[model samples]
Target: MNNEISDDNSDMIISDSDSNSEESIEDLNWIQTFLEKPGNQIFVEIHMQYLTDRFNLVGLNKYCSEKMSTMLKLMTDDIDFLRGEYSSMSSIEKRMLDKECAKLYGLIHARYILTYQGQYDMMTLYSENIFGKCPRSACTGTPLLPMGLYDVPEQDSFKLYCPCCEDVYRPAHITQGLELFSGFNGSVLSEYKRYQQAFDYPVEKHLTLRDSELPLGKNLDSEGDDLNIINQVLKFNPNIDGAYFGTTFPHFFLMQYPNVVSGEEKPKQRFIPAIYNFDLHYNSQILRYQELKRQQLEEKLSKEYDPKLIKTKSKKIFTSKTKMYT
Candidate 1:
């Protein structure tokens, strides 16, 4: 087994004369030029050996046709991997090889972003709002993350994930359509930690409840109903942290004020919404409220209507209709 592995590695090494060949030199020039591109500099540190390995490129052959015979050779300029006569190929043929080479790089990029360094780089981009920001007013322009709809290449385009709304949206940037897509076989990568970090901005400017508005020691007679309503909404995600309440359950505040209070009075720190949190639109909120009331009324009426009585009445109506038809 060791002997076989050594032979394979030795075969992958190109002779000095082969390295100086026209095709080999051209491959070298292409690689150098590609790495120098502004958008491709991130891949410079990622070695060609890993990128061209058969194990890492299991399903990428489907994207490349037979015209580009030696994919490994095109990428690494290694003579041992060469099978085709790239030196004799026409200009159009060389262009096809370049395109295939780029596709391979994209496949490698999908793998790269899953690495620690890649994630760090992507996190930096996330902070800079390079991917683009959520357009929903509730999200307050929180930076979006690129996520593949399907792990398979060319299966689906990428979507923008909003940590604030905890939802996905079609990206606004046209060029971003060809962006990051996962090549991982199983589950897609999780950005839960990223979401937590990106969503920590203060939201006091958007939502603030004065001590007077809080139901803690306020007039129980007037604020009692309001407290009950708040408690009911809170029940939707009982285990949710106060800071992320709006992410789980959307709401909005018409008025805003700083929660800070002066010397003798300590600020009553209630659970204020996060800046990168979802706030339902006012009109939609109204519709939802009416829908909830309608559901409650139906539930109340349902208890009075016996299922057995309804079934009996349906059977009698069926019998009358059948007799008339006969």
Candidate 2:
């Protein structure tokens, strides 16, 4: 299992005997430093295929024009600019360019995932469980899918959900899990929001996970509290076999239960959000994508696609035609 990655995010490899082929760590310093970081690593050689059309990145012109140019050149294997530009740009400018290069890849990624090929490619990744497996014991390694609790990036972070368990897990112990798999925080966390500082390795200081920042299906509940203490499961209860009916009416299990809010019996420890994925998926993103496809198809087909556009006229001479035949 030397090459087999663990769900603990691969840090469990306590020791390694491999030696570097090139001993001078300073050699190829920039390339080494860049490769070591997760920023542009997601774009890797695989993303170079997308650099052919800058037009696909229609709205990102304002980030860093020069860096974007550098990105294109780099993807095309033209490092001559780095060697040729001897004294013109400041180091700060160069740094910004590097930053924007990653940014540009991210912008393209958003468009890329929407393409037919991109979805299929991601589907393969999803099938492989590159996002990792469901953490619950009962799930017994259900492959996870990348999901955002909220579509509007910053409000909530990405989660790994198992359709079988109908539950969500914190993506791959958070940091190493994401970078190694998510595509610099993987495919889902791109363009919409900046990568979290948790992925900042070897340089940026560590960050502690907060109660509010805890993964979905997890909560900070006191032991004595009745609602939270009963059985700390937040999603479909892990104890039961068929707890997940569907995302619809999330509060149904708790809402219908007797004396949940008052009286003798203690309540089930489930909480419902004011807004949830069921609303966002069916009511927004999925519906929006479908509507967008419909619009595009209709536009391409023009008026011919619309049967409503055709007018039906009453035939006043129908009786006269019958009389002529008689």
Candidate 3:
């Protein structure tokens, strides 16, 4: 009888261990794949904690429907089924749910970036311009911060803000379906000065025609017309090389002369660039001042547009074929 009892106890212990192992494997099946990816292992604890409280997921429901909201909860609320039927669901269904889950996580991320921890995680990427560099030649490859025009999802996609130009531009690279809130503009921008100090990104001074008293439309038929115009406006010879300085000049001149640099200039459609068919409104006084200066320059240029110097088929000859904005 004593031997039989010991055998029964050992059998029970073995059976329990097997069950526990199976459960562990199931739990690992989904999250383990993500955790195995580079740079995600460190966030294991934090990600788990983010899903622990419902409060952290506020405002997520507005972006998803009833069914999707349920799926998001099932995926996040339960520690055991964190991946939410990824193995059992059909591929199409799994993809749809996965998309919603990802968006929900983006909403969470937007909120997270406002916090101390998320800011720390994003600081490296922000400083590195992993999102993209500013498209403007004047910005000089400055790192960009991702921001959304609207806080609501599906209303708009992400935009990149250049700290140097203090203007937002569409990302140079296509981001597919990634949507985020404008939380970065609020929190990240508020802390940007501190970030610059920490990263040793010295504030750079860029020359602008706005502050200069330049002869805008003088001597159109003169030798070295481009250099003469630039020199008079910039007040210093910026070395009219076919590189950075060359690219920078046309942006200011493009407004006055549509094909100033021909193939190099972005199509002169609008003064303020648009993002995904949405017109971007500028609140920056500096941009306003620059636009005023550009208008003044155009007025002067218009007075000197000799029919011999500048050929025009129509009054508005410039039209954009591409959607890219600088």
Candidate 4:
């Protein structure tokens, strides 16, 4: 009886050892598998979705209006030959359309880089020409108004100073206007100084263009001319270089997509496809950001999580199994 009891005890010890070893192996395998799965390996998708939803296409459009307008004009001009009756257009017209589409693709690629880089640069060369300069002391205690002029109070105007040259010049008279000093040439350095001072509560000079000098009519006339040219080209050849039919051609093609779709003849939805693409691109960016964030979080957790706690949990799992078997 004593021998049998000793043998039984030895067998129990061996069985417990095997069970613990198996559990450890299983746990390690699970951890390894979790680490290996591509999707599970990181929070890339979450980051991408966050990026996509965070990026606003409307905001991008507003930011790039001038650039987009220029691109549209160039595209229209390139495809002018194709904007007539199909029967009237020759082989040259087809060739021109193809060339214009290719040009547009190049333009899109270049513009994407330009716009992205401009965001980082903060100083837009286009805005400088279009909106003009912000006066030195326009709003002493307010945000810098790049696209508009601020009215400077007399009390605040006296405190104006240029941070660059340390010029303690008082705000110029409202009538004098903040002249882009002839020698200054509106360099980035000057602009940065002006922007910095504007952020602070420094006084600013307010300058307003006279109503008669505004050139409102000239601006309208230019826009009208552009529209006329676009219309003429569209009249000649309705197909807009095959890239969604130019910006203006969509309004007329709305009915062509009516639910009679059997083949790829489906008309493109007004804005959804482009919007979807934008969202996808935006989401992808967000996902990347999230993945980076997640990685940081994981690293932090790894450092902060006590190995003692994991060991304790493992002991509980193994100890409970030993108790049951014994």
Error of 3 at 273 (Å): 17
Q: lDDT winner among the candidates? A: 1
Order of models, best lDDT first: 1, 3, 2, 4
lDDT at 10, model 2: 21
Tell me the lDDT of model 1 at 178.
16
Tens digit of lDDT per residue, candidate 1, span 1-326? 21121322211211112222344443464465444332232232345556656676676667556423475676676654443476677666665566566555555656655555555555555555545666666555655556654444444434556655557765433122111222222221122122223433121211131223466666423443433322221111111111111111111110111121122232222233334576546755776676688679767777648797789888999999999999
Query: TM-scores across all candidates?
Result: 0.41, 0.38, 0.40, 0.16
Candidate 1 residue spans exceeding 4 A from truth: 1-45, 66-69, 77-84, 173-326
| Higher-scoring candidate on lDDT, 2 or 3 | 3
Residue 316 of model 4: what lDDT? Answer: 95
* lDDT pick, better of 1 and 4: 1
lDDT of 3 by residue, 1-326 (tens): 21121322221111111112234433543333322222121121236566546788765677665364455544444554444444456655554554455445445656655555555555555444444566666554655556655555544434555555657665424231111222233442333343334333221211121223236653322424333322222221111111101112213223333332343232323355568866556644556677788679877787667674455433334433232332
Candidate 1: worst-modelled 10 consecutive residues by lDDT: 248-257
lDDT of 4 by residue, 1-326 (tens): 21121322221111111111223321322122211221111101111122233232123333232344333433333233223332254556433433333333322322232233422222232123211222444222211111101111111111122222222332221111123222344543354355335332111110111122346654222443432322211121111111111221111122232231222332222222236346566666776676688679867887658798778878999999999999
By TM-score, is 1 or 4 better? Answer: 1
TM-score of predicted structure 2:
0.38
Tell me which of candidates 2 and 4 scores higher on TM-score.
2
Better of 2 and 4 by lDDT: 2
Which sections of candidate 2 miss by over 4 Å?
1-49, 62-67, 86-91, 147-157, 165-168, 172-326
